[model samples]
Target: MVNPYGPDTRGTFSFGIRLGLLFEVQAACLSAICVVGLLVYLGWTAIRTRRQRGKHALPSHLHVLFVSLLFSDLLHSIGSILNIPWIRDSGVLEGPLCTAQGIFRQMGDTGVALEILAIAVFTWGVIVRGWSSPSLKTTFVIVGLIWIFVILITLVSYGVHKAAGQVYYGNTRYWCWIRSPYSLPDGIALQYGWFWLTAAINLVLYISVAVTLLKSKRRCRNAQMPEGQRSLQKIAFQMTWYPIIYLITITPMSITRLWIFTNPEHPPPFAATALAAVLLTLSGVFNAVLFSITRPTLIPQKGHDHDPTVGGLRSIYTLEFCQRPDEDQRSSKIPPSPETPCHGEGTSKGGGTDETYV
Candidate 1:
């Protein structure tokens, strides 16, 4: 009798053998649980928001990018969760199901990376560059472009591989993906490159935003920074954690994949591969937890939307730092009123006015 699975045990099938398969199974199961919890939370929130329709309308315009990110995470988690079936069977092989997993994995990963990048860029523009929130048409256009790009790349790769009589997606030791032989081109082009790109851009944008806020704070320090400025600064710092968490979740798996790519002759240790799978699968959970931490108030209180402290992450979208230099002189002439509390009031000691971003 033959082992049937490849001898890549050391040089192949790192997780293919029964001894190491448990790790992948466990990782997928864990991801499923978290994904379900996230779904429940979203559903519950939707129900509550609907019930309070008169008091609170869904801030779909504000959270367009956010909702897209959550959808991507869902697809990615489902791809990982697919591994549960393989685990129960004790083996994986190339087939339609395998192909489906690979496609979902690639699409979801690419979508998530792109969505994160979009959010980071949008946030920086609004907060640091002083740009207004994007119009709904522009938002949908951007989101559509991202999905189109992801689909085109994945399908193109699949077509090319199929036409060449190759497996576009085949079994790795643990899960199905671009397969070992084509991992270099397909992996980098379809999946990992997006992750790396998002990581780099997000790190830079959030850092720049944080630094800008800090500088603004220092300028207002003597005058005593207004609560609005202070809140902006705090949120800026908190936003940095988004990229950090993203990096942490993807790093272990990235390292393993790169290691395998460069040194095909020497497969990583079983423990390394297993650990990487576990970490990578938990990305959805990591993202969910990070969002919860960064954006605590998903639904604003009935009448507290204007309250910066209670606004949560929504404040970043709705609050402006200081008025633009052009608006300052004119805005100051108008007296503050109930409808515009932060308009002309909240002046700093330096004769500059601090207004909540309207």
Candidate 2:
């Protein structure tokens, strides 16, 4: 019997069904587990922070942005997890589930790309441009604007298609997304455009930040370099993984999608498609690993305020270099130790600051 959910001839639907059997379902399941693991890690960290409430201050602006990025990744992973249903059915069907999957995928993909770009920009601003960390209020406003844009585009594009009696979130390949005919501009403008743009911007911003940090590191080799300066350099070294992880996760699927767009007649190679799916789905896992690796002190313990340990989430989440508070005016809540004096009140000659707490 012929499958009603797909065309009788060769096309996206047929290939998608074949592809699902070969790979998509397994990748989707693995991705779902990874996303869940990341969520549990973050949740546990938050709980630990809460128990130690006053000891550790609330999360910083940069920390909030990172959480937002993870939230977006969660959305994307949910979308990928939806693939199980389609793969089990062995074909794509036009229905609410399909629409939901498509919506989640678009929103998640767009959200991740935008968030990555925002982080890159913020990091560049703080490190390369020597700008002060933004206020929590400002960070909320920025996040609000990004979500507004994400929701607005999603509504407008999908709504227009619905009104015109068109299938905007229908089968394009192994998933429900922009279908044929309108897939070019609609898909590109709504999602892929942001991905590619963010990738390019990430490359430039990260390269600049890396260069600035390298210069600071070289200067830090001098015996006269402040301990705080050395700390900042070490933190910067760990941060080098940010763009590296992003590029690895985003590039393969991006190329695959672009190829499908350009050469619609010839489907992407089976192995290539499978690889892209696996890599793309593993984004959350990669990010979670990076988070743990870079933010060693995500859940700081009490009494460690004076710990000589430098770098990690202390820089990403708590450091505030902008105000450069007067030494006398600094809060006495967290006393400074000779080994790890609160850098909140001073700046190094190389323009780095210890600002390790609001």
Candidate 3:
């Protein structure tokens, strides 16, 4: 007698089986918690920023990009939170449910890519131009263009296959994926194409932003900045660190995709999936952490000493002033020395001088 759910056919008892399973469960739980927290934080921040701006407006173009990123992340987190339990109970490599899971996963992937692109572009623009109010019209146009391009590409490739035949429903985990019936070459190509293209774009954007930030930091160090302005610069540098976190968490998954594309015959079973899940979970958690730390004013402060308006205004003024070479040069000029006080009865040349403030 043979059991239907036995290990022999199902490919259980594999390397790192127990550990992988435990990690997957833990990652799912952690991701869910992070998603909940992120949603609350972002929602509150958006509302607060809107109210402060009056007429429900974003504080700046960069702020708009940040909001878009948070919104996309929230969507991805929600999808993952739902999909994880279903994957656990039903198994990702089996049954009709896999198709649904694949679709959701693909959507989440798209959201992540869009968010990263937005962050990279926005940060680059801010660092390069010192834009205080990024044109909303321009931002919306860029977002529209990206969405349209992605949709067109997806439709032209995967849409045709799914429409022409029953490409989705199968034991295959290729629901949101494009695959061939007889040969694996086409499927492999499509998979690698998507992963590599996204990776290349992300690498370029992040590297550019990182380089610009380093240059900015160097320039700032050479210039004399006020305490408040220096604090703002530090916050901006800290924000730049999120891209490194993005690269670390997403690079492994990209490499795994490349491996699978090159050698599809013997794809690692639970290990690869579990690893990808862990990376994605970490990405979501880190993003939430970054948002919290970099934008503390977005959080509701009860009896807090920090004034969000003054801080924001000072940051804006500093950024604007720093952009002007003439202003910077003029600011560096030395002030006239204070006039010497006349000596009194007990005053000597060194000891009797009046205390003077610049």
Indicate which candidate wins on TM-score: 2
Candidate 2 error regions (>4 Å): 1-23, 224-232, 299-358
On TM-score, the stronger of 1 and 3 is: 1
Model 1 poorest 10 in a row by lDDT? 349-358
Let me know the TM-score candidate 1 reaches against the reference structure. Answer: 0.77
Angstrom error at residue 65, model 3? 2.9
Cα shift from native, residue 287, model 1 (Å): 1.3
Q: What is the C-alpha lDDT of each candidate?
A: 0.66, 0.66, 0.49
RMSD of each: 6.9, 6.7, 11.9
* Model 2: pairs clashing at backbone N, Cα or C within 3 Å: none
In model 3, pairs of residues that clash are: none
**Regions of model 1 farther than 4 Å from truth:** 1-21, 43-47, 50-62, 224-232, 299-314, 317-358
List, residue by residue over 1-358, the lDDT tens digit for candidate 3: 1212221123333335545645655665565577567667656755664555455344444455555555545544453454443333343343344444444445455656665667666665555444343345676777667556544544455456568854442233311233324124543343334445555665676576566556555554544455555555566666566667766766776666556556665655656766875786566667767766776465556775234332332243223212222343454333311221001111112222222100
Please give the distance, in angstroms, between residue 358's alpha carbon in candidate 2 and its true position after superposition.
Answer: 12
Q: Count the backbone clashes (under 3 Å) in each candidate.
A: 3, 0, 0
